[model samples]
Target: MRISAVRTADRFLPERLSRQLNPWLLRLDQMLDGSTEHAVAQRVSLIAFLVRIISAAIALVSQVIFARWMGQFEYGIFVLVWVTVVILGNLSCLGFQTTVIRFVPEYLERQQLDHLRGILFTSKAFALGLTTCIALIGAGGVYFFREAIESYYVVPFLIGFICLPMIALGDTLDGTARSRSWVLVALTPTYIIRPVLTLVVMSIAHAAGFAPTATAAVTSAIIATYTTTLFQLLVVNHRFQAVVVPGTKTIRFGEWFAVSLPIFLVEGFFFLLTNADVLMVGRYMEPDKVATYFATVKLLALVHFVYFSVKAGAAQRYSELMHTHDHAQLSQFARDTARWTFWPSLMMAIVLLLLGKPLLYLFGAQFTDGYPLLFVLVVGVVARASVGPAESLLNMAGKQKICAMVYAVTLIVNICLSIVLIPVYGLAGAACATAFSMVFEAVTLALTVYNRLNITMFVFAGRTNARPVKEEI
Candidate 1:
């Protein structure tokens, strides 16, 4: 009897240990095993999640190094200039990035290769041309406003504008890759390669005796952006060649612009809403404070990546599912994604907050001052995650105008709150305002999703009675 009991214990112990140790492996196996919508979504989400994990690590390390190299004041200037350039570059895509995702899947579904080819070429060309124009206008504005701007910011800002065309092109390429479900190809160049290249270039410059200033850093970024973007463009074109084949193309500029403009509004508002806090902080505080706040926000990015990863993988899938009229599957998937976003985000938030001070210290001891703001900021990030990527759902479902309206309101609230509070409470006030805006944005988005699609978008929402809705397209 003793021998038999020992055998049973040995058998159960190993099995239990395997189950406990390799749960993610088991989940991964499930994800890759089938061709079902859920399975595909899971696989893409997992890939995107992993990519973000790597990107986050790379970005964190790079930012730390940059902060150390440039010191607080220069780092602050670089960050502010870079952030403004990035935001403008993305906006200059003029919604073509997301518009391509919406249109590509449908074009392929309908076997409209001509339309697909047209969009592939048109989006890049449109983004490049439009961004160039915007860049020129930005340069002119900088020239005219040079006297009014801070002397330190003027040169870097001018240099950063040179990156606009490439940034817009990169964004459009990302959309094309995503629509085709090429997750690695879609994400790797922009997220992984670009930052790595930026660090390498900056290090080389510093070694060559370039002063570790905002101008040097911005120059490195411009070089990195152009290099990464051009390389990405080549690779993407190569892939498209094999899959799409050569054919006569058609351009539907008027129709495409009609759809794209509203999407532009949506994305524009979202970008502004997300970055208004930083900009407002820069407006109200000194470079040292900006450095502290930016460092803290970078730490919080560890949590924010979860939502972005899920959204990146899920957007094309949402478009595909909507086109197929699979209301049931779409609703279920929406709920699943919300769960995917919230739990990981919640866990990350907890971990980041617990370790917040130490992580901020990595940037520098002074940065540790921003640690307390993490608690205030995490609430908003977690709240945004609670609704998952419902905005993507609405945009894919042809509710972009309404989605644009929601974001517009949220941006207004964020800006107003930031302006009102930053003067009073400083960094903490900025955090509070941003968090409140996030909560407001999440609630409005959740209600919009429920009312329009009959899908409960919140993480805690019950099973939805998903009825077939008329396709906006």
Candidate 2:
């Protein structure tokens, strides 16, 4: 009997050890199988967080390779031009990217298939047409103003413009996938595939005798953008076909435009605000300095992506909850998201800062100069995370105008601060400017959410009153 009991204990020991060792797997299984709306949102956020973590690693590695290959000056030029192009590409979508997130869920919930088909088609067509026009005009502007522009930037700018239409299309498709909670499909193309492809293509170009210059880098970007966007377009279309029944397409251009325009302002200012420091640094400093600053930013990407992941997962849920008039539940979920964002962000920021110098050194020994900037920049990232995705919640609740106003004001402050600070204090000044602006943004957003939705969204806030919304969202 004693021998038999010992055998039984031995058999159960591994099972007990597995449960203790991999509790997260058990939680993941629960998240996967749970039927509640919160469960789905949680699952999406977890998946997105994991995806962003992987993408951040890929991006960091690719960037290190690029810096090693092109050196700091060329890499800096590529970074500035590419960042500018990405901001414009998102703007060229004219708010349709988020507009779809707002409307698609509503349409699906209402079983409005015609409207769904109309929006899906309209968002894509509008993004392509509008961005194409922007690209052409931008190209002409660049040519006409060529003499006035810095010579090194001119060709890269032109090459980068080629990516505009495709970038906008990719963003729209990302939103399309996000609206349906297809988190992996929404994020992978932009975050994972595009960066990897750009690296591979750039390496190929260099191997084929193309110069290791910004022009070659931008050219690789063009090819990768086109390929990734087209691939995403096809995949998104397939997903839609499987779920959405075929029917006559409705065209509500006027209505969609009305919605998209304000969102465009909100998002446009938001992107500009987000990238303003980088742009300002480029304006006031040399390429090597820009490279160092950008490298620091890249190191911080792990912390920053936590907020983005939560924002991506929470927006559509916010839209559904708002429309349902589940104010109490919405308030609770908002607080939950704030927690989700802040804790992980705070944790990652600690880890990143602890390893900051070593990580920056990976970019190159010269790049290690960026280590000091991480301390200032991380404060802003964590501050922003404290409010979760307040803008997304507002926008989804149809409070875009107010949100746009808040962002516009915040952007103005960021630009003014960057301009005033970068020339005087250099990179440290830019870091301070960005960090201060983020704090301002967070406080303002928290106030706006409380005023508009009667929900407290701060990370440390207690249970909200859940009062009735003062007006239509």
State every prediction's TM-score relative to the real structure.
0.94, 0.94
Q: Candidate 2 clash total?
A: 0
Per-residue lDDT tens digits for candidate 1, residues 328-396, read 988988998999999999999999999999888999999999989998999999999999998899988
Model 2 has an lDDT value of: 0.91
Candidate RMSDs in Å, in order, are 4.6, 4.3
**lDDT of candidates 1 onward, in order:** 0.90, 0.91
Worst 10 residues of 1 by lDDT: 1-10
Candidate 2, residues 1-473: lDDT per residue as tens digits? 12333344446668776546455554555567645788788989998999999999999999999998889999999999999999999999989999999999888888999999999999999999999999999999999999999999999998888899999999999999999999989999999999999999999998999889999989998998899989998899999998797889999999999989889999999999888888999999998899999999988889989999998889989999988999999999999999999999999999999999999888899998889999999999999999999999988888889999999999999989888999899999999999999999999999999998988999999987767787754
After TM-score superposition, the amount by which residue 301's alpha carbon in candidate 1 deviates from its true location, in angstroms, is 1.0
Q: List the residue pairs that clash in candidate 2.
A: none
TM-score of decoy 2: 0.94
